[model samples]
Target: MDNVSWWAVASALAAGCLGLSVPGLLATLPLRLRPLPRLALAAPASLALIGCVGVIDGLLHLRFHWSHVLIAAAVIAAVLWPIREKRPLWSCPRLSALLPVTASAVSSVAFALVLLHQVPSFDLFSQSYDNLFHLNATQSILETGNASSLQLRTLINTDRTLSTYPAGWHTAAAMICQITGVSIGVAFNALAIAVVSVAWLPGIAWLTSLVVPQRQRTAGLCASLLLGTAFGFFPYALLIWGVLYPTFLAYALFPSGLALAMLLAHVWLPRWAPAVSDQVRPWAWNDRWMLLGLAAVWWLGAFFTHPRSLVSMVLLIVPLVLWICARAIAVAWKAGGARRRRMLWWLGGAFAFVSVAAVAAILVVFRVFHVASRPVGDHLNGPQAQAVQTVWDGLWQVLTQNALVGLGLDMTGSLIILAVVVLTGLVIALRRADLRWMVVAYALIAVLFALAAGSNSDMTKILTGLWYKDRYRLSALLPLLGVPLATLAVLRIAALTRWPRVVALGSATIVAASGWAGLWAPVGAAAAHEYRLENVKTTDFVDSRQIAFMQQVADVVPADQLLLGDPWDGSGLSWLYADRRPVFPHLNGQWDPDRLLIAQHLDQIESDPAVCTALRHLNVHYLLVSTGEFDGGDPSGNKFAAIDAAVSQGLFTPVLSDGESALLRIDQCS
Candidate 1:
């Protein structure tokens, strides 16, 4: 990478930490959470702020800048200040508290190192299908200054009708780009790294600490290590598989969301509910309305980022909800000694009514997200296609610590060790009532993963269809609570050991290594490092040679000129990197008639008047033609066959050329 590229990546990483973290910390000021919980919750709050900023600018039709984020954050903090508790949100933590913080930092470094290994360059992007939309959408937000989720689908929608999309993730990328002046690609990679480290690593660490009995000083450290490195399927798997940017981010911050749910479930019901007033209560929060206000901020964040996170929240939080309801029922039973039958009926009626309301709310959410319209990918096989069976398959995978995604990382030794760890956790959950709800939550998501991954039944579609029956999406949701259970289990095992610190550190190292390469690999660290290095040593997408050539193309191709080529052939990226618009800016879409006509008959420009007319109408001034395409990624050439023929006939003059790719001026079109 050149110095400019290096600067872009470094600046993005640095600026992203401040831009992403501060807004959230300020936003959480009014909420009655401890400093630790507040710190953990900041990521989600920052996401909410960014999402709102994007939507606000979209409505105002103005360019986004660093000022917007800071100004909005300032406004939010100032407004919330009067209502803020006299108890400050931040204070120096005890030296002992820094154990979790230290674990968070060390674990964050490990997580980042692996991710940096996976995506080696800031310029690297997924060669997959969805990323084309993501890249184009991000560029559109940066260029047009419209970041509204409702309007983002217009980039591919053609008719300008409002199409639903979760633009928060894409918007954040654009924010990074504008703030740091980095290309969309680098900005994206930098933001992903930042989210994992600044947002996810600490969030999971705090959640794990919360799950442990507080006296278990090592809970945060163990949780950070276990959750960050012990598992390959999540936090890492999601990054590889769709590059699943939106889902990855939402799920990353989802621990905080889950933490919030746990907080409300444990504290709100018992303390604030009128029926439970007679019960022992201990929380500074006297107002139920204030708690709901905190939830509203999280909702706004989740809603804009991805509605699926909300559904994921509901899925995981159900067990807790049930637990809370069960407690309410018991409380009503005690209070209803005299009119027990009448009180029981009232309680039952309330439960039934709430259940119906929840169902209705879920349906509304599904409709808003256009869940029914999304494709389920039944034709395309996933990681679940092989090495697994349908019924209870996801359940089995979780229990055994099996990886569903391709790129084999499984080892017998690692499997045995992890299996014992996870199963011990499950066994522990069964005995501990407080942790039982987490197990329930993990099981529910796993069941969904199974149905999505293996089943093709009508019922499967109905049940998992909310995720469009995409196993990757379901699999990503599985680890939200799964890691915490694993963390608790490691803590339990450490308690039984003579050298708990050594055991904890060693276990953390071995498990993280197991996920990367193998447990017993030669000199544990060396093997894991070599394995990660080999995977990212060479990327399958566009290379530095191609990037250099593209930069040259950008110099020659004027901003006003439009390039025409197949998106599948990689010509669509001209818009993102070169600032030269492409006639086809994405891989596949319900394209307008003009673009389709040109795609079908661009070579017939001299013979076909319609082709000539379309070319002129669309302002075709250049052509980006790749002579050879990516392995298995090449288009059929049926659509671009015209352009290939035109170039073969020497109809256009090459402005520049790299071995198989070139930028040509469109004199032939006339």
Candidate 2:
């Protein structure tokens, strides 16, 4: 890492500390939490606060300067100094108490290493499709001094109205870029890798701890480790897929928000219906209002980070909420002592019903009315051949052949095996009518994702819109809930047998390692095929020549001029690397008259006067033509044909040329 990168890391650290301390200072909630879990809270908390800054900057167009960053740091320090004035900086805990924290730290480091091993370096952004938008958005935030999702519409179509895209991750990256003078790509990549690998593990572990009692801290550890290695589609596949950075950041923080919600509900349920209080254990923290306030804040953080995360978290928690309400109502109906008491209980039930109904109505409105206008595109509407093939190759191979493509071991077979274990745990938990709601909630989410990835197109589309229709996005939620249940199942199985403790621990460890390896199998196989990363088929995810060509384009094209080219062919990347704008930066339906004109006339620029007129009107001063055909179509030949025609007709002046790419400036027309 260079100096700027180091500074970015330092800034992340400071943000982490502030994130942890701010919540502590405000709620003193960590007083009830273990030391390590408190540290985990800092990561999301810092990101949330930084996200808030980004949101404000974007909405208000506030410049993110070094002074602003320094001021933010100073405020954090001021808050921390007073809070730590009387209390010890670190909590003193027994050695056994440190196991969960140690496991979490180890898992984070391991996950970071795994990601680094796969991604290798942050020199280039992931070749995932959405990175085009994310990188440009980061650049826009850096230039405009705010992470405005709406402002980024310029990349799509200059004429479109502001849209409600979440820019929290981009905003944080912009902050890093502003302060460190590193490239936006560097800042974005760095923050993403750090949060996902380092912060994400601890966050998951802490969430697991929330549901897993103090006695089963080992289960939490196991779950955290499992998260580090298992479910390649989630944390790893996301890196290679859309590389959905905002969703990744939000997902990292989601569990913490969930933990907070669970805590809030635990506290709230007792108050709303006292009979259920006997069933639910009392939280050590007495400040129910404070906890609720903190939970709400955490939820806001998730919302700002990514609306998908908030939606998913809400979906996961809805069952738990309903179950709690039902228990409360049941308790109220069962109360037979006094008329006044029964009336009060009924009143509490009514209040719960009204509150739940109101929240549900608001969410429904947000989804149906508010989000209907946004441009998510119907890309995943049809039954995708690739989805079916992926399922066949991944799950089928594991089941029938007893092997995954990359891993030499038969590790993937455990997906079925552990799935059974999870189901068994859920059944037992439900039979006892204990805290099985948590297991059920996650299971429902998992099933929803599976259904979204199902063979049927229409059902998949509807389910997919619920999660942006990305299986990887939906898959991210599974390990957080599944691992803990798996841990509990393992513990239960161990208790049933007279087997030595070592046998049980060893078995769990093997399962964790195998599950991790299994998940990596399909991802590794898919990487070479889908992305052309190492295995280099004719498909173009990215290449050295493209990178070199982009660098050349950056060198020749002025930052101020707009370059017209096919975004699908990687020409749009100049906006991120070269600070040049593209007429059509992406193919995701950001339509405008100018964009339509450019697209229609792109192949006719040299042959027709109208094409030149439209180009001039759009102020497209330059053309960037890449020689490669990509996902959209074979734009390489047509674009070059247009370029060649322009040069022949003396309509364009050649500025720079490489073998497969050329930069041409449109000549002044009479």
Candidate 3:
């Protein structure tokens, strides 16, 4: 088979094999109880299995190759073989009615896949700044055969500590790349598209299935389609804008994690905390063990994939638990005397336990998300006008900005419309048990956003400490609350109007179109070959000539010698694609002491023996000069001045020149 064909086959087998594993089967149990088709479980199951594989590989130090993945799959299959003989995949009796919803979700994914496939070259490498670490880190995982980020530090800087960064995405991509002989970049991009299409799209459908009534599946499905398509920041913007592949993967898995938590909470809480039974109708399903197991596996998937996502789940889940406790206490009070005291004590213990657990979890989060070695008290810089503007901007963007809108559908207008409709629906059906949870969820998110939007430095620290204080990251999660309310609004409006279907379709169409507008450039950029240095500065087309020049330098430079190059000139790609390590692995040069030292005297390297002494210390071999786009405009302070000075002082000899860039051997270093 050709390389592309091999990649398809390998990726299919890796995902398929994972799906057939024990955790994969376990993860499908809760979803199986729903009236959805078996295929709905494929993506989530596959992703959960990938997380399982990551854990196994990390512990065993196994190389992330097809052989290792297959072995792990075999072990899981072996354990589950006896159970599979007795029970087959569940068949949905309502499959005929559910086909449209399923088809809509699948089609949305397929459309996204087509757009992603059309991107130029399919080289899979992102042109964004952050992709330097992401792409190189994946390459490191492949080279070392260690899927654990803890030990995968050789790619970026050898001085960096054991990494706490999530490695599940990299491991999955590395498996595809190793098995198919594709580049890590190609595998990574393909994996990302697959995640959005297969994992995220279906996962949303599954969450909708959990939240919406069985009869109203179509409304929920429609809402998911709009969410998958129309929302720009979530699956698309996060993928393209920040090139946050790990975060995207975590977010994609979040719906499934939430759905599983909802199921488990509904079922398990009643038995453990019976005082909370007034608010929760204890589900007495025969598959209780299966549901518990499924929730555990999904939570594991979330924790390993991205801690931020796991934290989001906790925030959402806590409100439901508190509501349950509050309801039980109210019911106990109505019953009077001993029952009230008993319920109080029960809830008091529960509250204490939850408090302790939350504190412990937050500590873990603080450590995992910590920005190591940075000066903490160096206050964050913001524009003078931003303090007040950010309060509104952060709150508004959290609610409405991520998705694209048009045809006079302003985000503020949309929010006002949706709020009016949802509140109207809640009043119309005040007895809905589900509405309570929905309201609680929305309220919790609003509170989080309020804290996030606070102008105080401490609030900023809290937000950053919790979710990187990134508005984009917070916005990426808005759809979870946004989509459900949107669906509710459409349904409520339909119930009020004589033409329900018309109202629903109209809302879906507006949402879908507006969202599609937001994603046009990002999706189109694939084929357009555009790359963004940052969100504001975008290069229309990737310059392949510059890439070729870097590759030539990589080929000539000794493997052990470190080269110095400006990261903004895309030297990180050389480390990833050409196996050449640049002094600065990331675009920001302020963090690394050694890199900062080199940068401080780069222009004086030819005349300054001290600078030459540092160069010799690093075993520096060459300097790469790019005649392309870079951060700073000054030629003197930038890489050009340093190169010109070196040449004038006869301290270096030009070994290769490609007009676009050049490689200078440090032959006359001090």
Candidate 4:
């Protein structure tokens, strides 16, 4: 863990890339889209495949091996093989056609390097709040041989029979680690690096092309990747703040799903505007059905990755959904008969009912997750007017092509090239009716961001709660629409220049290097956090010395025994790190009575018959004691009030110690 192992990083990166993308690519090969869009769609497709296979394997009580994923992909490819368009007879294509693929690939590599260098270490984790739970859960999948989202709840609470955490991210990480033979920590870092761009770059490229064709040039592709990757608001902000890997993966994959959904809208419902029809492929009926089916699978995949992102995706695409329905109704009314009109009204009523039902279901999920009903965390701890100011700052940031809102970074240092283009793109989108919906979508997202960042009102909670009312998430979304608009503006510039492609490359460089437009502060902060964490004596659950001591735990303690420690205190990580199970595997869980008994009276084992009985029943002979907790808040750990009494009175045999971290055996119970 000292000097980084670049070879391990490389293998983990390759395996993570293949595990996340290959299955989806094979499944989507039957689609006739050009290279960029097709490639972008592959990742989510694979997510759907992997998550479903895990769930199925869980129901049937089967172990999840890496081969199971490949077999699933083969089955899907074989099933979809019949629908292949009968056109090409193995004819060689021109080299010009490969430009988009080649350029995008190169840009992805550059972007990936920037992201890695931004992080202090490619192997060590950032240890943001949620990572401990996610990391332990990924390890649990390998240990229990049950990767079903439903089965994941046991990792948090052994007493629970049913719960879900959208294990798509975990399932994929498990497979990557298994295939590459790397630790979960290394595999996860690779995923954090590779899984992000799998959907994003091509998705944005296809979207830019679809929105504004700009004379069928590769400049859009070039500009999209370069400018798209330069912005630190999105994918980078995510990797840093919460290290919100599940949401990060879901967001990367959602753009393609959104683009496909928009395409489906165009194909199924012809618009009054000619531009909408002209931009989309003229798919056959069979193709539409097939695409719809794949889109459904992608939705499931996104849900499996993280339901909140699916919620975000659904929220962002509301304008398009409303437009499609409105267009269909208008077309129906124009050719009206009383009977047909009546039927149209009935269908509209039914659609409205279903929409209401869906909204209700979303609200239910919000309540279940304790989101949106009340302010969460530090959303608005200041005065009321500061909320308004934050909203204004957010709008200003979006307009100026600054994604980091109020992070205290100097915004004026960067040149305004990207800002000017983003505004120009906004102007262009407003003028073109087909592109107008994008502006509408952007506005809707901005309003949501305002509610999230500025207000903690009940209505605000309802709207922003699913995201835990986090401005970082809402701010990150502005680029979901803004980045494509920026790419569109660059593509327009490229169209006018004699050297269009050169303009694309040069523009990305100016914005990136021009006072470090979007790349400066995020890179500094992320690197500082990641690199600093690597050397810190303590971070959240586990400490540096504690980690080294844990490496020796398995040698002294039998593999079949369990560790007694507070998950909050970090020693509970022995379950995942040292391959020794812990009585409490997470910070919180619906613990069984026996574990609860030991937690309350473990120090009284010499005199309390109940404590000894519970310890022996659970086979908990070893105790991992530490005085620290994640976030430096509550160090209650396993809640044994007199636990440290053992150290003072020699109640237990000391097995190992490194600073405050110690391992002990309960001899009195034996």
Q: Residue 254 lDDT in model 2?
A: 69
Candidate 4, 98-185: lDDT as tens digits: 7665666665665566555555566567665577778888888888888998878777676678777899888888998788778887
> What lDDT, from 0 to 1, does candidate 2 have?
0.57
C-alpha RMSD between model 2 and the true structure:
6.2
What's the distance in Å from true for residue 303, model 4? 2.1
Q: What is the lDDT of residue 482 in candidate 4?
A: 75
TM-scores, all models, native as reference: 0.84, 0.78, 0.76, 0.88
User: Weakest 10 consecutive residues, lDDT, candidate 3?
Assistant: 404-413
Q: Which has the better TM-score: candidate 1, or candidate 2?
A: 1
Clashing pairs in 4: 372-461, 372-465
Best by the TM-score measure: 4
Candidate achieving higher lDDT, 3 or 4:
4
lDDT tens digits, residue span 354-406, model 3: 89998987676556545354433333333211133345554565454433211
TM-score (C-alpha, index-matched) for candidate 3:
0.76
Q: Candidate 4: where is the Cα deviation over 4 Å?
A: 30-33, 87-93, 118-120, 272-281, 326-389, 404-415, 512-517, 534-539, 635-650
lDDT of 1 by residue, 126-230 (tens): 665577789888988877788878788877776567777888788788878877788776777778777877677767766666666554646535555445654
